[model samples]
Target: MATFFGEVVSVYSRAVEEDEEEEEEGEEDAEIRREVQKQREVHLNWRSEIAESIESSSDKTFQCSDLVIAVGQNASGFLSAFVLSTGNWDVVGTVTLWNERTKGPSQVTNTQLPEESRCVLYRQAACPSVVICQCTYYVAEDQLFQWTEKVLGSIQRRGLRVLVLSDCSVAEYKTSECITASPSPFLRTLKTSEYRDALRCPLMEQPNILTGLPAAVLSHCQVHRIPAVVYQCYSDVACPDSLTMEAYRPALSCLSSKLGKVDYNPSTEVLRKVVRVSEAQSNLYT
Candidate 1:
């Protein structure tokens, strides 16, 4: 009878131990669920905060002051130092560089940098900014000269201080902002459709000096008053103002030299128009 009693006691003990283990497991499961809930809340809050920031940023306005950009095929970007130098700008814009690979080549409307070359160019160039790409339609467009005129006319309407820089400035640039260290007088014209579009012009069967393509482009810039500056790739090569691959810079110094030093700041009110950012990109974590 005692042995039988001992067996019954052992069975009861085993049952109690099993029940304890199950309770412990249940508690562990509850703890895990709590942690998961906390993490989910955290992620949601983070997203909401980011969205709000982006939304509000669009309300910010550019107060078009002065702009300096490093124009290039691959490393095209606005220098941050230039931004700081020309702080409280009314507007800023950066072109999609030709050389860098686009990070998200699919999304088109949000950013305008090229698919093959995307270098956070606009991040530093934020403010009443628009992206232009030569690679996109330069090769496909017909009536290139006509199209270029339209684009430049549009840029002129914006009314901002525009300064273009070469791979390196060979001459000093004079502007409201700091002077360019190595100004390339050859690189003076704004990026326009005149030359690229003229290449497609049928007057010449091939691209050469004889086509009078250079004369046509020169006349276009002169009419538009867009200062054209060409760049030389290397020191060994002479900088040719006429070429397919080229750069552009400002000629404020030349203007001053011709007309004598005149501080345009007193008349700066002409470019003081302020424009707010679009509603969409304000809070984005650029």
Candidate 2:
């Protein structure tokens, strides 16, 4: 049978759906409500911690960050560049992304580098620090969660406000919502069914199929609760279960609360609100 995030996908998906259906079945079910309330408490509490840091920021500006615009190593880092731009909140940073198939797109640019060369990614300065990382779903699904967990964790500990937008995480998008029947083709003999059909699914034995990364990525950056949002563009049909625009707004509300009541949402007009999110983020540090 298929698995999800190291758990039995079929069973877990069905359970979640059933839980939702059961919720509709009896609106006044106190027990179910209590259980759900408890889960929400955990989720919201985590969000609260992130918001606290965002609210306490000293500056009053914001930044726009995008990562990994497309394939090819040269243009591959476009989204990363966007995510790293930290400037006036009123003018979010612009990130350009296009694929460089092979060699430098610019004649003056040298695609080859010395074998001994090495570079550092960050510097402590008045400007917002920039970090860029890229990976695909199939390439690094197993370590996806753990690696980002560390990166995000460190960024938060530094106290600088952060705006993180990963360019990829389609597998996560799929696994978070869909129910798979089997993880490995090796289990050909096993019966598979929709997640709605299964229960108490068995533990998965293979490495995570989807990078168990996005939720963890959100969790890490969100820990600081910096006034942040991600703009992800899907270049292919592989887009998974994207959170609805409606659902995303509420999360921003939760994040904005952390940014000291600034208008951190997209719909609000900053010109009238006069509360800048970028400057606000940087000053939160030091």
Candidate 3:
């Protein structure tokens, strides 16, 4: 049986086909289009929150920030290093991903680490915080959602922002319009010729898969009323393209703008400058 995500792929494939049979089913086409429209409306409503945040932030500067939890994926080391280098912001380390190719579990580790690691560590910081998920579209949506619900939701104060960073090659590109409502917005299914161009091996050797993880995770944030941002960089990761960091501007600004709005919870005391050594050092504190 196809899962909900799987059904999405099937429907997308059918929707894109140019076959005569599809034209014969005008009523069906209209129905599918309506469903897609509904999804788009939901996404637009969700994105409006981000746009509003951006607008609301244009007039002020933030005063309350000390900690940042950065999670990296394939380029964990590069991304983590970049974040840590910019300042002393706490990099909590990578996310632990399970159920990949049914190979059990794998940690999103630094490039220096093994392909899979048994122990994944994260640090606890007490201060105004933001979570950055860098190129983490491969992560399971349900897991990401649950983590957001627990971590971001648990913050007694209001200023927890989730920033998603993605790098895309030409082949991986999808219109922002198409991805706003899907799970793996950063990835698209490979075409036969494109697969041949990238890998000399037979196309059959590759998996016929597309990912909507980014959109799924973002949608989850929207559902929970969490402030989130996404930005994409272009490079050779998927295709040979000129590199630039321009995509980061909007995300950074969004973070800055929303920081002032974060409320302080005296009881939780996450806003404190100093955390107890026991609380700060323990990964289990969350």
Among the numbered candidates, top lDDT falls to 3
How accurate locally is residue 202 in candidate 2, as Cα lDDT from 0 to 100?
A: 32
- Would you estimate the TM-scores of all the predictions? 0.27, 0.27, 0.38
lDDT per residue (tens digit) for residues 67-162 in model 2 = 111221211233212222323321111111112211111111122222211111221133333333332212134334444543343343433333
At residue 257, candidate 1 shows an lDDT of 33
How accurate locally, in lDDT, is each candidate?
0.30, 0.29, 0.35
Please tell me which predicted candidate would have the highest TM-score against the true structure. 3
Off by over 4 Å in 2: 1-75, 79-128, 134-141, 156-158, 168-212, 223-227, 237-286
Candidate 2 lands at a TM-score of 0.27
Comparison by TM-score, 1 against 3, better one: 3
Off by over 4 Å in 3: 1-81, 89-94, 101-128, 133-137, 140-157, 174-211, 234-236, 239-250, 254-286
